[model samples]
Target: MSGYPDNPSGHMSGSARTRRADAQRNRERILQAARELVHEPGELKLHTVAKACGIGQGTLYRHFPTREDLLAEVYRREVEDLVAAAPRLLETHPPLDALAAWFDRVAAYARVKRDIFAAVEAATWQDLAAHSLGPIGAAVELLLAAGRSAGGVRADAEARDVIILISWLSRLDDTELDARGPRLLSILVNGLRAHHRD
Candidate 1:
């Protein structure tokens, strides 16, 4: 018998496994570096990202293929993280608390989106719209429904309103946002709360 066992699927080889692990690590490093740098001044440069990740331009290009691809992937990951947090938050907190906490996360997501739009000015409305608000809308709907059922929120509150309110954060400066975000968010949460039962 040969030193290596018969592996038809090809991934069972030790060298293949090592390469896969290395690729995953490199991919993570590239993404982390991009996240750190994309928010800074000026446009994003692939070389800078590669240098920060300690990887060659060839490797970065191999993984992302294009700058738009990289930006889209990053944006998708951000939305996915936000959408995934909804269920976890609901499980851990009461309905109203969960809704309030989700708004905080939405603010953070808006910040990330602002940086992304700044860095990739040509990322097109269609490119953005392709991400589809379905997941986030569903998350907000779940929270709103829970809040209403628990008698914590107004019966007329809509999920789209929460999204629109949180989106306003994208228009504020970092300094002003830091100063006013809490109060503004408090107003928003209070507005959503039930003042009188119908």
Candidate 2:
């Protein structure tokens, strides 16, 4: 053999692995900071997010080259997370209860989306929504399917209809949401009961 250590696995060097892990941690931190900052009043500033995350602006830019890039990433991750929640919710709760819980999650997502829209251009917002529709619809369908199978939701209930019904949640002001959101969701859940007209 040559005057070198034997190499088998092609794994990265320890320093390289540490750098990769740090970059991933930084990306997550940036996302978390952006998510919170987007909800604050006025336009979102990249520098503010960098400051919040305790990273330099250049570091932030390396990860997200533009403001739109950062916002879109935040939006995409939120949609991904929301879609992933459906199956998890069903695992621990009854179908109808899981559906209700998912509705609440959707409301929270709506609030984040509202803030994202304010920060992003109309075109960017449209693009984000277009990409998000499929996954979000699938999540809703998953929850509905579980409920229907359990005889808790009406057989005729469609995911599209359920989406339309809850669309109003996005329009509610903070005050109205706090005052009426839970009651409205309760009525919605009750209305979707299997016994409700086919």
Candidate 3:
């Protein structure tokens, strides 16, 4: 046999890897709990999250030093999920349809932002806002380019314009928004559509 440790399970096998995997699982559980709790005013208490996660305070703190840190990570992960949806939307629908679907997703994201805005205020919301739009802008540009190429959207459209239109949806009161947001967004999408050619 070789001089290396006689392990039948490959070159590495031990509790260290198990501990790391457990840590990762705990981290995800903590974030999920945070996401749910952030929607409730003053409910983002870390102890609550730890209790929900069934982990010690030390484990939660190991993943996030402060409530603000946890909030920022949660928001960042939410934005990442939004960005990741673009390709999946495109795969399932035509360009314009995909863009429309993505607009709906954006509306949902904006609602979440409004819900969590109070908690996020204590964190680096400005810095997060500054950088978060880049991924969204790029995703919008991709969708718009595809729409124009497919002759489904106006050639003159820019991602900034759509972003501006969508931003308005986030500002409305939740009730009014719930009542009219879809109609307003439909109009916006309809306006963006390319005129039918002969």
Candidate 4:
């Protein structure tokens, strides 16, 4: 027999596992860099993203073949994170506080999305919005359900209505959002309260 160790099972060897880990690290670095740079003032170029992440262009291209691909992944990951926060927040905080915190997350997401949508093609933006709507709405519903059960939120508060109420966040400029986001969010949250006066 050859000097190499025999492997009957299909599990990845140590070297293969290391390579996979390295690839995942590189991908995450790229995404993190892209997320930051996308908010900057100029056009987001692939080379700039690769450089910011300390990865070579070829490596970046291997992970994301086009700028649209990278942008789409970033947007999708943002939505995933936003959706995943609902359950975790509910587990840790009171229903009303969790709902308030989730709204904060939504405001952050809207900022990033507004910048990203400006960079991507209209078709890409449309596709991303279509795919994200259901999961995001569901996340809102989850938070609202918890609040309603706790008697902190109105039983009649619908996810779509909440969505519509917050949609204007995307239209605010960065300065305006910074100055007004918290107050606006507080108003929105209080409006959903079970005991709020008309």
TM-score of each: 0.89, 0.91, 0.87, 0.94
Q: What are the Cα lDDT values of the candidates?
A: 0.83, 0.90, 0.85, 0.93
* Model 3 residue pairs with clashes: none
List the candidate 2 regions with Cα displacement exceeding 4 Å. 1-9, 196-198
Return the lDDT, model 4, position 198: 65
lDDT of 2 by residue, 104-173 (tens): 8988887778788778999999999899988999999999999999999999889898888887887887
| Predicted structure 1, TM vs. truth | 0.89
- Which candidate tops TM-score? 4
By summed lDDT, the worst window of 10 consecutive residues in model 2 runs over 1-10
Report the alpha-carbon TM-score of model 2 versus the true structure: 0.91
Considering summed lDDT, which 10 consecutive residues are worst modelled in model 3?
4-13
Which structure among the candidates has the greatest lDDT? Answer: 4
Candidate 3 scores a C-alpha RMSD against the true structure in Å of: 4.2
Instruction: State the lDDT of candidate 4 residue by residue for 34-96, as single tens digits.
Output: 999999998899999999988899999999999999999999999999999999999999999
lDDT by residue for model 3 over 22-99, one digit each (tens)?
889998999999888876656579999999889999989999999889988887888898888888999999999998
Q: What is the lDDT for 75 in model 2?
A: 90
Q: After superposition, which runs of candidate 3 have C-alpha atoms over 4 Å from their true positions? A: 1-14
